[model samples]
Target: MLQLYGNPRSRAMRCLWMLEEVGRPYQLVEKTTHADDLQTAEYLRLNPNARIPTLVDGDLVLWESMAINLYLAQRYDGPMHCAGPEVLGLAAQWSFWAVLEIEHLLLNFLEHRALLAEFARDPSVTERNELLLKKPLGVLNDALAVRGYLAGNSFTVADLNVAGILMWGKMARMDLSAYPELTRWLDACLARPAYVRLRDQARRK
Candidate 1:
């Protein structure tokens, strides 16, 4: 059986959701971030970065949440599986775009607005990144305005990966009313059964 190391609340949630979508049987190894479990030599062998998420399948070990999801989608027979090279390329494109163009901005805004202690929180940082996020959000909104999904007609890894990062924006309580299309798309993505199951599992703690 495949073993995935990470807590459901972490980026591992994305992999968990993908696994659920693929209807695969796997074990969640439950390594919480900043915990000693991730620092051990055994765990380091699987993921040198000491990250929460590391997947082990036989001799193949993979880290990075997005990469893991993309692999699962392509390797498995499921709704998220890429149909062809073009679909796979678009999936990778949106996944990378989400990480590079949007993830850091959302992270900074979330850290300042919610994750940080009151004394440590910086409204300036939150404000600046929130402004920065507008451009990409608008771009996404425009893209969604023409298509229901990012890559193809149906929901795919591209949607999953991008939505996974954008979820942090929702956590930050960023006003998204102006981007109706993006808001609708995100709402639909989060409402999927797989994502719902992931959230339910995350709430168990």
Candidate 2:
């Protein structure tokens, strides 16, 4: 069986959602955020960064949430939504675009707003980061205005990956009113049963 290391609350949630969508029975190898867990030599061996959501399938080991999902799709042919690049050009496009565009902006906001907010320092840089996010959000909103999904008209990995990151804006209460199309698309993506199960798992953690 495949073994995934990471908490549901982390990026690993994406993989969990993919597994559910693919109907794959797998093991969730819980890795806590405790300092002890991260500092352990054993954990470091798997990932020097000691980040959550590492995948181990027999001899194969991989990190990075997005890469893990791609690997899962490639190896297991998970579900129609995650069809391989050759079979589904749009699916791959959206999937790759999610990490390429959407994730870049969202992660930037997360690091600058959430992580840096703790120290209350870098106020100037924070404002700059906020400004940086607007351009990407606008681009995404424009793209969504014409299409129902990021890659194509139907749900796919692109929708899941991009929506997963954008959902954070909801928790942060960062008004997305300006991006009505993006918001509408997100609503549609969140309505999926696989995403629902994935979200429920995150709440459980």
Candidate 3:
């Protein structure tokens, strides 16, 4: 059996959702940032970076949530799997875009707006990030408006990877009403049964 080491509240949530979508039998080992589990020698052998997510399957060990999800989608037979090389390329494109263009800004916004304590929170930071987000969000909105999905007509790994990052936007209570198409697409993606199952499981932990 495959073993995934990470806490659901972290980026591991993305991998967890992907595993659910792949319908694979895997064990979640549950390492949290708040604990020393990720720093231990045992965990370090799987991921030298001491990251929250590390996947172990046979002799293969993988880290990085996005990479793990992409690997799972490519290796497994499931709905999230890419249909072809072109689809895989597009999926990789959007996944990288999500991390590079949106993830940091969203994380900063979430921290300042909600995650941080009231006294520690910075309205200026949130305002700046919100402004920065408009451009990328508009780009994403336009893309979704064209095909309803990122890479293909139907949902695929591209949608899953992008939506996984955008989940933070919803958690931060970011106002996305300005981008109706993006809002609709995100809502539908998050509503998928596999995503719902992982989300509920995460909350229970």
Q: Per-residue CA lDDT of candidate 2, range 57-129, in tens?
A: 8888888877776666666643444444543565456557667765665666666666655776555654665
Q: Any runs in candidate 2 off by more than 4 Å, and if so which?
A: 81-105, 108-127
TM-score of each: 0.97, 0.81, 0.97
lDDT of 3 by residue, 1-205 (tens): 9898887788888888888888889999978786477777877888999887889999999998889888998898767778899999999999999999999999999899888889999999989999999999999999999998999899888898889889999999999999999999999999999988887876786
What lDDT does candidate 2 reach at residue 21? 69
- The per-prediction tally of clashing pairs is 0, 0, 0
After superposing all C-alphas onto the true structure, candidate 1 shows an RMSD in angstroms of 1.0
Winning candidate number (lDDT): 3
**1-205: candidate 1 lDDT, tens digit per residue:** 9889887777888888888888879999878787587889988878889986888888899998899988998888767789999999999999999989998999889899899899999899988997898999999999999999998778999999999888988988989998999999999999999999888867886
Better of 2 and 3 by lDDT: 3
Clashing pairs in 1: none
What lDDT score belongs to each candidate, Candidate 1 first?
A: 0.88, 0.73, 0.89
Order of the predicted models by lDDT, top scorer first: 3, 1, 2
Can you tell me which runs of candidate 3 are displaced by over 4 Å? none
TM-score, cand. 3 vs. native? 0.97
